[model samples]
Target chain A: MSVLGRVRARPQATAGVALTLPVAVFFVVFWLVPFLAAIYLSFTDYEMAGTPNWIGLANYERMFADPGFLNSAWITVVYTVCTVVPTIVLALLVAVPLSRPGRLNRWLRALVMIPAVMPLAATSMVWVIIYSDRGLANTLLGLVGIDPQSWLTSSDLAIWALVVMVVWKSMGLFVIILTAGLQALPGEVYEAAAIDGSGAVTTFTRITLPLLRRTLLFVLVISVAGSMQAFVPAFLLTGGGPADATQVLPYYIWANAFPYEHMGYAAAMGMVLLAAMVIVSALQFGFLKGGDE
Target chain B: MRAGTILRAVWLIVAVGFMLLPVYAMLVVASAPDDTDLRGLVFNGFHLPENIGLLFGEGNLPTYLRNSLILCVGTGVLDVIFSAAAGYAMAQLSFPGRRVLFALVIGTLALTPMVLVIPVFLIVKELGWVNTFQGMMVPGMISAFGVFLVRQFALGIPKELLMAARVDGAGEFRIFARIAAPLLKPALITLFLVHFLAQWDNLLWPLIVANEQELWPLPVGLANFQSEVGITYHLTTTAALVTAVPPFILMVALQRYYVAGLTFGGLKR
Candidate 1:
């Protein structure tokens, strides 16, 4: 029996298939099915109704002329760029110093991660109060000797207010990640650079950045993807706004999906967003794929 | 010391201040009396218990808390198992279609889950799972990121150890249950905590599927209260505190597991 079993595909192979089967089933039913369905649904007008009417490319075409969709597409782009840039930069700033080996840096690493752990819906309430007229915004402004701007209510500042809050929420995790990445770089190179009398900026730009490309690329992809899917803040804090200033694509898509019952339309927009994530991630890869071995 | 050592301490102190200011504000407002002066940052009274009682009383918060707990546990426990099992197989075993299965996991990574929300909802509804716990928990039980993280961690397990176990005539499932699973402790804990956090913060799917208040989790319930202007500042702050305090405690207690996630493979979020 042992010889016969050995002659066949390894007896342990069944265990592998059995072990992998659950996630595979989940991937198919939840991931693959929905993915294919999203693609198919984007092409049809299903609206939670009897039958999905096939109208090839119509929803995608309508997205262009639709002002709401257009505004949201633009807002999403703005939100992604604004949030991603500051998060990476600020996180890098905090990371560079905190990367040093010390008990303070170690403990501070967890301290910085606090906001990232807050429930977005819960934190949005706090921000609503902060951005309110008589709330912390005005009080803080009073201390700083600057007038309080209506943060969320003002169309001009609403998105930026949310951007600032999100940068706070996001920057910490990246700080920790970047800190680890910085710690992992070869130490001898820094020693060589120090011997050459290299300045801080010079060593960073010349030696550190190139070595840190993979981590930065990883961080960039994560930040970009996360920023694009940011819905809770806008949904809970701004309600897509005094105008549609804060109506990110996900917000707009949610609006269409539930409130307006534009399921097919939302799916189409979602597909576009998915494509945007893929493209942006690819671009980050390509752009950062410098002449490193 | 490095050139910026003193400067670095000052920088981090300010950043910590920024990081903690909201939590402090939450503590202050959460403990204050309802309809108190919102202009100043001071405690009106130590009414945190009273405010929390309000949530437990009329806010329907107990239900929300219970649902959130169940959702987090269900998803977290399942994600750890499914991910670890699948990851173990891919890393350690010789399977017929290992490459194909691994490719499937990779394929999931390329697609954004946000986009699939509609179709996933629709499918769940079709399965008669709308407004059900299973509906919310099942769709997200397995994360590709979780699978990849587990696989990365599992790859570090010595090949000879598994081979030795096999040579000793132990069944594959038994060896995995008794040996491999125990060895993957840090990865498992990390996966659990990460999924727990994600599930606790899950709002969007539950928002649509759980249209009824009875089924709403804290995130959805909190959003509902805020959106409709029904929830008070005290209750909002209290709920924020209530939601945040658990994770803060968890984080402080298990800082090692959280950091272990970063050290393991990559971002598990």
Candidate 2:
């Protein structure tokens, strides 16, 4: 008998299959079914109170035309860019030096991860206090000879304030991830560069950046997805407020679905968000294809 | 030390200070007397116990804390067990459709919680599980990332050990229980930490499904209290500190496992 046939005939193999059945079935029911339902609900007007009515493409059409949806989509893009770029740059700055093996660097690394481990809801509450009129942030700004700007109350500044908090909260994990990538880099390349008398800037730009492309891509994609789906800061700190300045897509979806009962409309917006994430991830893979080689 | 090393040391200290500043502010506010001036820094410890006591005595925070513990611990244990079992199967067994099953698992990784929230709520509603503990916990019991991580670790286990046990007429369950389970301890611990943190910090889904005040978890409860009371910094900061203490303790105690799991899950190549 063929090896495949022999393996299939064994009771142990059947046991393995049986062991996997519970999770697989659970996922199918909870994950796969709901995912399909989300798509189906996107195409229909399914209010929680009533049965779904078939209304193909109308929800998507409304999504494109609605000012709230358009504004949220724009805000989401801006937030993602603002948060991801600064996070990667700052994390890289901290991580490169911290990657050096030392007692101090090790302690610093643990210290930085504290914010990332804390619950965002709790942290957002703390930030709301900091952004208050007579809060510590303003006190620090006053010491630097600046005015106490309204952080979460200003239309233009609220989104930026949210960005700052998010970057602070998330940078630790990225720093750790990038540090691992840095430590994994072969030291012989650095030695060769040093022998050639390559300057620090040139070595970093040429050797370190190119080799860390895969890790950078990983960080970038995760950060973009995270920033896109961010809800706690908006919900807790600003309530997507100061005239909807910080009203990103996920918050918009929540508003429409729960409070307004526009479940179908929310589902359509969610589909758009999913599509955007998939496209971003696919483009990242395509762009970084040569990094592995 | 050289000038460059000194500069780097200064920068590291500043970075650490920046990271801890907000937390320090939280501690100050939570522990400050209610009528104290809120403008400048007031680091006091007199009101710490009183504020925490008020949070529990005046509000439903103790119930929320209990619910959070139930959900996080329940989901953590279940996620580890389910993921380990499926991971072991994919690693050691030669069953048909294994490749397809594994691919499906990986595919689910791309589906974020935001995307699943609405439909999952609908499913819970359909099953009449809204406002219940099982509603909050059951749907999230299995994590795709956990399964992937465990599978990667399980692949490193030698296949010969399992084959040896099988040849000795031991049942597959016996081999898994007596042999594979112990070998998977490190991976399971890592997976448990990851799932526990995720569940512990979860806010959105719980807010949607558990509308009943008695059923609310820490995040949702804290958020509701903030909005309802409209920014009473002393009480809110105390609540925040109370909510943050569990994960803070866990991260500090199991720092290595927490860091490893996060980095491992992120840079899975």
Candidate 3:
């Protein structure tokens, strides 16, 4: 057979290969190459001004001893827990009622989701205003008969302030997700529970929670992964804060790579972040799957 | 039952209010008189146009907006096209390396761009694309999420249709363009909006790659405005409002598709 005939004989194989080439090529150049380069760079000392020199795990050792890395790791855990837990709970609280079928509920759901769609940088700017001493937060505090307090400037409160903004920005998406999960649930189960004289709280705890475990796990994994690498809010709003209180992992990596010229160290930190995310996701999957029985 | 209905309504209203308060506060500050204090600015002033004008007039916000548009539109179009083509192949065609490619794409989905910033920047610098539009747009062009979304939608396309086209001696590309592309409109729209919003809101990558005023996108531009304008709430909030307008309009207009896109990955699993 001629080459054209040979190729034409299996249209699926030829066309599939041809069609997949663009994304494959792009992914290789953009993602694969960069990913491997990050791994390689983590082991080398590459100042922007010069060629990289292989240093072989020195960067990793330095990170283990680095106070900034330790601070950022601690902050990452705190930030992730603060943002992820509230986002899941608040989203669930709002999504359950909004999941009901009605035009008004749909509109209300859209309204609540508006913040999730806003540009984080812009929203962070709004938050900077809100968290300012004279901003609405303090004003609202005054309404409650409390003293006006500096929010972002206070080390103890800066990370918490960021947590509030992140939850506002992120929870809506989870709400939508959980709402979908709620809608997908079998109505027959709820009907059975009602016939059995199960109360709302009892049905939710005994049935709804267990049934929605997979969806909840999905939300948990995504939220935790996102919060671990959060950068823009901390950078734009706090600039890593008054005493580095809000210096999460990604911010620390950025500061090292750009401002401090510690490219190897930064890449090493990125590897750590990648590992942390994988571990967290794996743990969630394992725990959730174990509960299936 | 009546009490339950009222409680649900109240809960939703409170949630929506909490969600919108920051946005509403932003609008109030953006429209307030320049020297007004935050306490005094209680959605009373109506100087939105003037503040917007000042934002574009005194700063490089217009340039930033233009650059951002180019970046977002470019990323969106390319992401859609690339994802559709690849997704169609993965979903319909039988090819070698298909499984491995899908796995690779899925793997990339787990690796957030934030973790790859330093190496990606190095790659861009190596390619001589720093401070260039390509630098800002290319790495963001083909997200694994877009590919996965398109592939899932493409799986629903009837295989017989493609076979019939093949029997009629239609070209593969022609079959995709004539059949698959039209059928994948909803998914394509979802991918486009998601990619557009992502590119529009992206800050850190652009901040690193583009240092020139003309190359700055809205997010970076808004960040710089904070430093340059000091504590001028009117101008800063005005700039932020402008930065937010595109995605906000998109979300409001295409809420269904946008939400579908948001929940696509989660629900599919």
Ranking by TM-score: 3, 2, 1
True C-alpha contacts between chains kept, each model in order? 0.70, 0.66, 0.77
Candidate lDDT values, in order: 0.84, 0.86, 0.87
Model 2: which docking level applies?
A: medium
Tell me how far the alpha carbon of residue A261 in candidate 3 is from the true structure, in angstroms, after superposition: 1.6
Runs with alpha carbons beyond 4 Å of true place in candidate 1: A1-8, B1-3, B227-230, B262-269
Q: What is the interface RMSD of each candidate, in Å?
A: 1.9, 1.7, 1.7
* iRMSD, model 2, in Å: 1.7
- lDDT over C-alpha atoms for residue A98 of model 1: 83
| Candidate 3 residue-pair clash tally | 0
Tell me the TM-score of model 1: 0.94
Q: Which candidate leads the pack in DockQ?
A: 3
Candidate 3: misplaced stretches above 4 Å? A1-9, B229-231
Q: Write the per-residue lDDT of candidate 1 for residues A1-293, one digit (tens) a residue.
A: 68855843476788989999988888999888889999998999979766789999999999999999999989998999999998898888888878878998878876777876777777887877777887877898999899978989899999999998898788777887888789888899999999999988999899988888778878888889888998899988889996999999999999998888788988999999998888888878788874565
The window of 10 residues in a row where model 1 chain B has the poorest summed lDDT is B260-269
